[model samples]
Target: MALLELEGVTRRFGALVALDQVAMAVEEGEVRAVIGPNGAGKTTLFNVITGTVKPSAGTIRFAGESIGGQPSHHVCRLGLSRTFQITALFPEMSARENARLAAQARHARRWQPFGGAGVFRQAAALADAALEQLGLTSIGDTPAGLLSHGDQRLLEVAMAMAQQPRVLLLDEPTQGLSVEETAQAVDTLARFLQASRMTVLLVEHDMEVVFRLAHRITVLHRGAVIADSTPDAVKADPAVQDAYLGGFA
Candidate 1:
């Protein structure tokens, strides 16, 4: 069975259909990229899969369990984690602290009156490991707000990873980054993927990054899938070219 599956999923906002009978399946350890022009329902798809937005219709399954409309926190606890397009961090907190909090969320006793010192220690270890994986160990003590924008982006990814999720959804991870920063983030992520073989569903505008990391590309246009295939195949597809990749190919 596919690790993540969405069948005939639809979402509407009044008269507007943000997602129209979308269907896709992501295999275990597969890196699937979802790309499109603005307002093509890319982010909405992520929100729905992550349970931030309830689907107007259809079913979503992760590890063969129905999860549609279950709620964000519940979905997250089921081993689905994601990073947002906009960096969301506690600016005043140190990088390590920020990551530690995310790790703690995965602990079963996190809500207990006294989760205990062991829980905090374990969370710290996981956080530090995530930071190291993202090459942010040196700046672990720095306030998240003081880090460079590139580092901040990387930090958000590290925080997500600290949860040790089975599926990671990255929404425009390299958005607002300079060329150099983008390259750095991509390289770091590439290395992590190689080591972890993590399943990822990415929504990225940078075609270069999308092509480099994706095993399969699924293109969306006007709230529906226009093309879904290998990167080269999708690039050469006439429909994809006319709709979004006119000059990128």
Candidate 2:
């Protein structure tokens, strides 16, 4: 069985049909890219999977158990995690502090009673490890609010790693980053997934990142999956070229 499965999942906002029986399956330790134009329900799907939103129909099964209606915290505690498109960091805290906080959360030990233990020890080590992996170690001590825009983006990703989730959901992780920053982020993520064998689902407009990292790509158009195939196959689909590339048709 696949590690994650969504069958006939649907969500609605008044008259808006955000997801129309969108079905997807993610196997263990694979990267699946969900690509589409704006308002295509990509983020909504992420929210649903991560428990930020509930589906109006169908079922969601993770590791063979139903999880469609659980709260987000419940979902996170169950080994699923996500990073926002917007950098969600504690601006007042230094980057190292933020990462330490996340690592502390991951320990899931009696430390929970202490408010925020593990901030200065191995938590710091985990933070430094994550920062070094993402090439953010140089600015590790800087306040998140003071870093450059691209560094802020990388920090959000590092924070997500703090939890060390098995299933990682990233929403527009490379948004607003320069080409060089984008490449760096991609290379960093490639190394992480390759070594950690984490299952990743990324929502992005950048086809290059999708094509580069994803083993299978699903195209969402008008709240429905128009195609699901390997990167090369999806790129060659005439409909994908027409809808995604426009006049490149």
Candidate 3:
């Protein structure tokens, strides 16, 4: 069975239709890239899957059970997690601390504001492991807000990884990064996903990054899925070429 599946998903924002009858499936331990031009409803798709945006119609299934109506926290508890387009972290806290907080939250513990930030057992170990995996061990002790933009993005990944999620959702993981930094982030992501055998659904505009890391690619246009195929197939698809690549070039 697929790790995640969306069937005829639809979401309307009053007068505007953000997503329309979208259907796709992502297998476990594979990277599925969702791509398209601006206003193609990529972010809206992420929000729907994460439970931040409710779908007006259709079913969302994860690991065989229905999750279409579940709230965000409930979805996370089911081992689904995501990072944002904007860096989302505790600005003043060290990277380790930020990850630790996520670990605690994922483990169903309430956030505590007292005592030594250094001794949080389960969360501490998970955070450390995630930092090491992301090659962020060197800056684990530094405040998240102070890292270079690329490092900040890495820290966000670490936080999501700390959740030990079954399915990872990355909303433009390399957004706002330099060319070199974007490549670094993609390399790190590819390595992390490979090592963990985690399923990934990423919304990205960078074709290089998407084609390099995604096992399959799905194209959305005007809030609907117009094409879904392997990287090479997607690149050659006349519909995809006409809707996106034609203009991307």
Candidate 4:
């Protein structure tokens, strides 16, 4: 079975249909990109998958089990993790500390009367490993708010990686980055995914990044899927061209 699957997923906010019968399947270790025009429901889809928003109809399956309507924390614990479009980090915390917190969330025992030093140490080690992998080890001591915007974005990704997830959901990861920063972010993310063999569902506006890293692309229009195909096929599709890519090209 595909690692992640959504069957006829629909989400509505009263009169507004944010998503309409959206169906998608992300296979193991594949990087799938979701793209569409503004208000096409890309973020809404992520919200539903990550359980920030519940679908009004249809089911979501991860690793062969149903997970639709599960709480965000529960879904996260089940090995699906997400990073938001806006970087979410503890501004006052150091990069290492932020990463350590995420790592601890995966392994810490809630029953512990007092936070154990051993657990903290283990989480710190994991944080260091993730930081090293992302080439952020040198800046691990820097405050998150003090880091450059691109570095902060990369740090947010490291925090997600620290979760030890089976699938990662990224929303506009390279948004607001400069040309050089965007290129760096894409290269760094691509290397990490390839090295770790991680499955990813990404929402992004940068067509270059999407074309560079995605194994396939799914296009959405007015809350419905318009195309799902390989990068080359998607680029050549007339419907996709007319809906979004024509202006992009």
Candidate 5:
């Protein structure tokens, strides 16, 4: 079975339809990129899959279990984790601390009055590992708010990775980054993904990043899928060209 599947999913904000009967499947170990112009429902799709927003209709299954409309925290515990388009972090907390909290969330006993020392130790190890993977080990002690914008973006990703999710959802992971920073982040992420082979569903505006990391591309336009195929195929798709990739391809 596919690791993540969405069938006939729809979401509406009042009278405005944000997503319309969307359907797609992401296989285990696959890196799928969801791309589109602004207002095309890419973010809405992520919100729905992550359980941040309840779908107005249709079903979402992850690892063969229905997840549609489940709470975000519940979905996260089921092995789905995501980073937001806007960098979400505890600005006052050190990078390591931020990651550690995410790691702790995965532990069943994390909310206990006295979770054993072992739980804390494991969470710490995972946090440090995620920071190292993102090349942020040197700045692990820096406050997230004090870090550069690029560093904050990478830190958010590290925090999500610390959750050790089976399916990672990244929403514009490289937003607001310089060309150099973007390249560095992409290279680090690429290396980590190669080593982990984690399943990923990405929503990104940067076509370069999308093409480089995605095994398959699913294009959206006006709240519906316009094209879903290999990167090259999607790029060449006539509908995609007219609707979204007019000049990017």
Candidate 6:
């Protein structure tokens, strides 16, 4: 069964029809990229899946169970997590502290903030592991606000990883990064996903990052899917070429 499925999903903001009968299926352990022009409802799709917005119609299923309209926290508890287009981090806290917070939140069912030394130790270990995996051990003690933008982005990923989510939704992970930084972030992400085997659905505008990391691409236009295929097929698709990739040349 597909790990995450959206069938005939639609969301309308009063007079605005943001998404229309969208259907998508993400297989387990695959990196699926969602791409579109600015107003194509890519962010809306992520919001709906992550339970930040309820779908006006249709069903969303993860692991074959309906999850549409569930609360955001509930959705997150089900092993679904996301990072935003803007960097989301505790600026005043160190990178390791930010990660530790996420780890504690994830294991809160067993965590006691003021109760035991062992719980804090476990959370710290998880955060350390996540930082090491992202190659951020050197800056683990640096304040997030002091880190470079690219490092801030990586720290966000580390926080998400500390959640240990089975399905990760990354929205514009490389946005605002320099060319060199973008390349580095792409490499780190590809390696991390491969090592963890986490199912990923990312919304990205950078065609290079999308083509480099995604096993399949789903193109959205006017809040609807215009193309869904392998990277090569998507690049060759006339419709995708006209609507989205025309500028790539």
lDDT of each: 0.93, 0.84, 0.89, 0.90, 0.91, 0.91
Candidate 1 segments whose C-alpha is farther than 4 A from its true place? 108-114
lDDT of 2 at 186: 82
lDDT by residue for model 1 over 1-249, one digit each (tens)? 999999999999999999999999999999999999999999999999999999999999999999999999889889999999999999999999999999888665554555677778888999999999888999999999999988999899899999989999999989999999899989989898888899999999999999999999999998999898999999999999999988798
Candidate 5, residues 1-249, lDDT tens digits: the string is 899999999999999889999999999999999999999999999999989999999999999999999999889988999999988899999999999999888665544555677777888899999999888999999999999888898898899899989999999989999999899888888887888898999999989999999999999998999899999999888899899888677
Query: Which candidate has the highest lDDT of all?
Result: 1
Cα-based TM-score, every candidate: 0.97, 0.90, 0.94, 0.95, 0.95, 0.95
lDDT per residue as tens, model 4, 6-28: 99999999999999999999999
Clashing pairs in 1: none
Cα lDDT over the full model 2: 0.84
lDDT tens digits, residues 1-249, model 6? Answer: 899999999999998989999999999999999999999999999999999999999999999889999998888888898899998899999999999988888777756655677778888998999898888999999999999888888888888888888898999999999999888888988888878888999999999889888999999999899999999999998899899899473
Clashes in model 5: which pairs? Answer: none
- Sorting all predicted structures by lDDT, with the top scorer first, yields 1, 5, 6, 4, 3, 2
Shift of residue 141 alpha carbon in model 6, Å:
0.6
- TM-score between candidate 4 and the true structure: 0.95
* Model 6 clash tally, residue pairs: 0
User: Looking at candidate 6, what is the lDDT of residue 127?
Assistant: 95
The residue-by-residue lDDT of candidate 3 on 79-131, one tens digit each, is 99899987789889999999998887777544344435543777899999999
Mark the regions of model 5 whose C-alpha exceeds 4 Å error after superposition: 108-116
Q: What's the lDDT for residue 173 in model 6?
A: 94
CA lDDT of 113 in candidate 3? 47
Highest TM-score scorer:
1
- Indicate whether candidate 2 or candidate 5 has the larger lDDT: 5
